[model samples]
Target: MTQLKTLFFAVTTAALAGCAATPRKYDDESSRALNLARAGGVYDQDLRDSPDGTRSYRKGLFTTLLDVASLATSFDAPLRHLSGTQTFMFNATDIMATPDNPSARPSLIGWMPGSLAANQDDAYEHYVTVVDEAITHAAESMSITATKLTDVKTPEIDEHPLMLWSVTSERYDCGKSNCIIAYNIQQPTYWKTPSYVTGREAASYNIAANHPEEYSRLIFRQSGDERTFPVGEFYSAVSADMPPWIVMYFPPNTVFQDGEPLTYPVLYEQGQQLMFKEPNHE
Candidate 1:
């Protein structure tokens, strides 16, 4: 935990000092062509699972002592060593809609899930279903008809007002603990690839619009007999380039004392509370 905090501090300092590089400029024709070429797949596996990896700790005297105690008593190994480091995997899909066209409608690409742990597949699927419902509801809030994309791949939306909807989710099991944490995030980016380029300078080279960007995460921990709530800001518009919808149903920075089914309302609350806790959250 101390190491994690130190790493977070370093990253925050770098970002605050303007260490990020500027994006290279592309010609108008090239920009449009590049975006279209990259947007073919229903699922961008690389983007969805950006920081997908594992982190482990070197055994120390404290952990060694605990291991010995576990062998002599009925108590199990400490939770930190048993499931301290986490390996995260995500499943994501895309949807496209042409809201500007009077006769146009929304269409989902096929549900192509990435790799996930075998033990957590069932829970992950349930969580995906809940998120799918949320995405559909979000579209309806914007006044559009939505449909699940099945038995299909990329859809053709080259020359139209496009809105791409995407979602990703993960589930974490709290062994011998009171709460289970489910992590999920969605960033919906769209380009108005209309027949003509708008007069705006930025739009002259690329598509442009303002939309919500959001991330929803939940984490559970156990310390003695006390329950520990998660802390962080789950949703934010970090960049104007990527716009996500208002996925505020799940409140961030929350804890559930009882073992209840991880439903939408629960997620909504958890999502809202997570926003302020993690300064390093991307």
Candidate 2:
């Protein structure tokens, strides 16, 4: 009995000593910041199970670790890089309208003299050219075929305007072992109304108009052995009335960094907190 007690005490002491020997440390301020950023108890909820009947807790943990490592090293570190060719589709829809009654022309409350050149006509024309160039550039850069820009139809001045674009690209590269495809769409504010007339309202309007450009870097990744793994989709309607919409979809098991998989829950949680809120979006 004495020998058994001694053996148990020895084992417990060794375990405690082992735990004390492995001290947790942060290399720098950036590492500490990253740790704090991800440790906000936001991801404490149960992770949604993947289609393969596996939970992605490990993937989430690894992603947090990779984020910390990236911050410690370089902020410009590429989220992902593929050596083989990739394909993407780009589609945009815009509704054009002109006031039929001269007296009922849309009123411009805050039009400045210097910005007159960017009137509705000029804005529409520029939007067309810019979207066209953007699609062409994306296709060329990703080495994929894209559908020609589709101009659906024009509406009357009183009718609500709509602008939406979608892209779908699929290909296998990197020694033909891995396959990847990305789809993204944006629906910008396309209507003019007097509801945004107050100073605060106008300011909010301008910010919402420009939100997409600011939040475009939010990317999600998933991984799978077969290229045909299920794709994950995310969409947001910022406001109920005349709200801007953004949608993105990608295959499962997509990784932003080596060995770090991006999951839907992580992206959705981050996006909901960041994009749809007050201070963050403002």
TM-scores for all candidates? 0.19, 0.26
Per-residue lDDT of model 1, residues 192-214, tens digit only? 22222112122111211111112
Query: What shift in Å separates residue 54 of candidate 2 from its native position after superposition?
Result: 18
Highest lDDT among the candidates is held by which one? 2
Per-residue lDDT tens digits for candidate 2, residues 1-282, read 999999997786555433322222332322221111122111122232233322323354434322322331231122134222211111011111111111111111111121323444453344334434544564455554434423433222223222223334464222221222221212223232222122222111111111111111112112233323222222111111111221121112332323443332222221131111112212
* Deviation in Å, model 1, residue 248 alpha carbon: 9.3
| lDDT of the candidates, in the order given | 0.24, 0.25
The local lDDT score (0 to 100) that residue 79 gets in candidate 2 is: 17
**Each candidate's clash count:** 27, 12
Off by over 4 Å in 1: 1-118, 154-282
